[model samples]
Target chain A: MNSASPPDLLTRSGSGLLNWLHGWRAVFRFAGVAIVESLTPRTYNSATRSVVLKQIYFTAWQILPRFTLFAALLSYVLIQIVVDTARNFGLADYALEATIRLLVLEILPLMTALFVALRSGAATGTEVVLMNIHNEIQAIEAAGVDPNRFEFIPRVIGGAISVLALTAVTSSIALLIAYVVVYGPQYWNLPDFARVVAHIFDLPTLTILWAKVLAFGLAVTVIPITEALAAPKKLFFAPIAVLRGMVRLFFVLMLIEVLSLALKYI
Target chain B: MRLLEETPDAALISDSLPLRANLSVLENVAIVLQYRRNMNYDAAADRAWALLGRLGQTDSAFKRDPDLGSEQRFAAKLARALILPQPIILIERPGLLLPDTHYPAFLDAALTAVEDLFEQCWIVDYTWNEPLYAPR
Candidate 1:
């Protein structure tokens, strides 16, 4: 009974598209500001340092033990599967390379990013949304504090560092597990494993991996916070803000992963 | 209130300006000094502890916002505001922040406790609450 005319429907579609573009533009702008503020030497005072340390402790250190165990188990199982499949096809020589490419270069970083995004990203988003609703951001500003410098950028830095830390730990363990799985824990296969590692982890590959993981880390925290800041200052919008943040973050993470793969192989 | 807003050193204590829920009461109070004065964590914590001590809120130092009593939450907000250098304390609508308590008397006692820390103290409330501030 209330169907819109063609012109009205066109206008509504145009408006929705414009709003979508505006949201993306806001996210990029906020990310740029956070990056610039984080780089400024003056941002590393005692206050922000404390915030960053607490963030890292919560994001990486607190979950390190349990997450590492989980990742190790997963890596071993995956490596075994890859190795078995390769050996069945008389391609055992390519097993290590495939495992390294799959696990170390791609899977571990993505896993770590997802973990941080789910745990710390959601928490940061909810906290920020609540702060916005309660006018705490305004309060901090009124007290002569730059919430960007004092509150937000520190979290971005900490989250990025946490991602890198988790990725590094898990990736290293995965590599070790790959070796033990492929080479039976023998010291005699050390030189062969080193050769495969060096061949796989060339400068470009390493650089791309680092860039991708860093992008993942930044996206995890930055997307949530940007979305949270853009959310309406209403109690009901808190969950919506986090949901949008998480969805956007997942998209960005996948995009980065695809781009990295394209750069390395395509 | 407009005059207080015009000043750069004004520190507001209101229900709208809630303490950070993720942070403990001590962290909430100490963070002001840490951010503004660049005080180290230990020093800021010590100073915040002293401020909370002045309000007999040391027992609630490590508690977070949700865990705090109304009086303790108000004390944390007050301490956070008072930490500013030569702060002009702006206490807005005490009843909104401490609904169950006699806020006028509590504000009087709390302000009297930290009277020397602030340059001036202003209480902004609705006309309906005017008689509550009148001298008995």
Candidate 2:
């Protein structure tokens, strides 16, 4: 009760706000640096290409078959649920539209983002933090390597590609599963299914979907790496940085997904 | 013989090395430096001399001596000397040695050391059962 008075408290609160702003100023500045580097011709080196390839291999290539199956099964189950529910509510005509919107555009990207975020995001965060702590990045820079181009930007590119490839594979499988669930192995409905695909994945919708996936991937890899790099060499703060990165990544993924949904639906 | 109670404090002591950096500041700065160029050590030293003098090193031998006074002092000096622009994480603390009353001062000093050395800083801490890993 005898702490700083109201005016003092206001000053303290303003200081906290200023502190938060200062922390983000560094982040935004770094992000600007990343963007400028990304626009340059040297951004596409062999190392960068290899990092992108490795990210794709780990994210999309390795689990492609499993993710497809999982997406297919999940799509089938969800299509059935939506169809049955819609039919019970006497809106069976909306089954195909709802299923496509839900499975292909919504759940798949979010699931892929979460999956990648969990696997690679944590690793990237820890790796960046350790490198920061150990001064390895400094060593690299001292040796005349642009650590951002050589090490980081490539990861960002790789992550975006991985998200795109994974989403493509999963969405395709989900589409196939949706058809099977709705029409039950009948070739007669193939054209009808194609029409729905065409309708749902219209140009604008497709563009947004792809962009969102890319953004999701970027958020997962970039945010964590950035945050980890933000952490001090103190090992204890490493985990906290990671935690913050993950939370921010999760928030960004949700925001991207919701923004995409709002753009598509509303 | 009075046995020290094996509370968190005792556990903290047994694991001194792990907690050695417990109060240290950690930072990762991907980009830094007001200016960078290919320069010889002599010029770099000349540039860094004033900043080095301002540091509160008590030992005259350490202040003027070519050799670093300690591991921590050397790191702080090198970052200033080299002007290398890279992501840096620096941890500075008296470690888990001081009492809680003195921790704030220790923490401030450690952070100041790291902030002087690098742009990014993290304060590593320890709690019960936090995962500690050796770098591969």
Give lDDT tens digits, candidate 2, residues A136-243.
Answer: 665445434467876688777777778887888888887877787778887899988888888888899889988888778778777888788878789899889899
lDDT of each: 0.89, 0.62
Candidate 1, residue B39: CA error in Å? Answer: 1.4
Top DockQ hit: 1
Per-residue lDDT of candidate 1, residues A161-249 (tens digit): 99999999999999999999999978899999999999998899999999999899899999999999999988999999999999999
Put down candidate 2 lDDT per residue, B19-59, tens digits, no spaces: 11111111111111211333333454443443334444323
Specify the highest-TM-score model's number.
1
TM-score, every prediction = 0.94, 0.63
DockQ of each: 0.64, 0.02
